[model samples]
Target chain A: SQTIHQWPATLVQPVGSPLSLECTVEGTSNPNLYWYRQAAGRGLQLLFYSVGIGQISSEVPQNLSASRPQDRQFILSSKKLLLSDSGFYLCAWSPTGGEQYFGPGTRLTVT
Target chain B: AQTVTQSQPEMSVQEAETVTLSCTYDTSESDYYLFWYKQPPSRQMILVIRQEAYKQQNATENRFSVNFQKAAKSFSLKISDSQLGDAAMYFCAYTERSQGNLIFGKGTKLSVKP
Candidate 1:
């Protein structure tokens, strides 16, 4: 079975600091990757999505950016973080025309 | 752009009873997909059910099923014999046929009482 993994299950970063979050899929090649954020009491917000390597689409424009360095590896980074950047980050994967599978998620707190 | 709406911010049901969570969407395209996702206190997002706009028959998985009214653009989820485990924040999502993006609603928090 295919699985998704996310690093730093929980993170605490100071304001104006840099940010780097990684997501990887195992047992699946060329899968669609997505980055979503859930605020304290809100729904999932699609931040970015990638259909293939080196291809990325931004759903919402902000301080965050996403990159697909490899076929199954996606990275979310920021040169400087903002206080509003704090939220629960979820990484998901799906096959073309298929339902998405979510990773364990990373709770990022930007103080 | 496709949009999903879940009017109920919170709902509660007695254990072993049935509960229906309402979800409606708006889209100009005829070909699309609707989904219901469950997010537990653990914060993991899980797919509860999905309905294709082309399929007239509602999709069902075990105790979960959908009431898809394509013409009305309404897709509601029904959970039979609701259990404590069923308590969670349920979100309604939509994705157009040609798009890879899944748009989500604000979500409804469901609580099960024993």
Candidate 2:
């Protein structure tokens, strides 16, 4: 069975501060990884997706960026946080073009 | 470009009854996939059901099923014997066969009353 992990479960960052959120999947290799954001009372919006290491496809243009440093390790980062950057971040993984499985997610608040 | 639409912002159902949440999508591709995901109060997205465009038969899980109308571009989720645990925000998503990325709808908040 494959499982996905993300941390910190919750985060609070001040404006202009750096941001880093980590996601790692165990029991799978060369999986497709994705980053999605959900604002309060809204649906999810895809931010970025990676089919392989060092290959990322961005969907939304914003302050955030994503990187797949390893086969199963993906990171979402930002040099400076904005108030609009606050939202719930979710990490998901799929087998090639298969259905996606989600991580526990991280609640980020930028004050 | 593919787009998913879930017009219902909220719905209510009685426990042990049935409720249907509507979803429609637009896509130029013939082979694709449609999915229904549930986000509980905990906000974890859980896959409820999925339908493949090539298949004509409706996909069904234990208590969840889908009405897939390829021509109509309508895919609706039906929950039978609804339980309190079924209360959640349901989302409709679409993806192409060659694309791993998904396009999601606004979602419908389902409330179950006992």
Q: What share of the true interface contacts does candidate 2 keep?
A: 0.63
Taking all chains together, the TM-score of candidate 1 against the true structure is 0.98
Model 1 off-target regions past 4 Å? none
Query: Can you give the lDDT of residue A80 in candidate 2?
Result: 99
> Would you list the C-alpha lDDT of every candidate in the order shown?
0.94, 0.95
**lDDT value, residue B84 of candidate 2:** 98
Q: Which parts of model 2 have CA positions greater than 4 angstroms off?
A: none
Best by DockQ: 2
Model 2 clashing residue pairs (backbone): none
Comparing to the true complex, what docking class would candidate 1 get?
medium
Interface RMS deviation of candidate 1: 1.2
Q: Write the per-residue lDDT of candidate 1 for residues B6-69, one digit (tens) a residue.
A: 9999999999999999999999998888899999998999999988889999999999999999
Candidate 2, residues A1-111: lDDT per residue as tens digits? 999999999999999999999999999899999999999999999999999999999998999999998999999999999999999999999996757999999999999
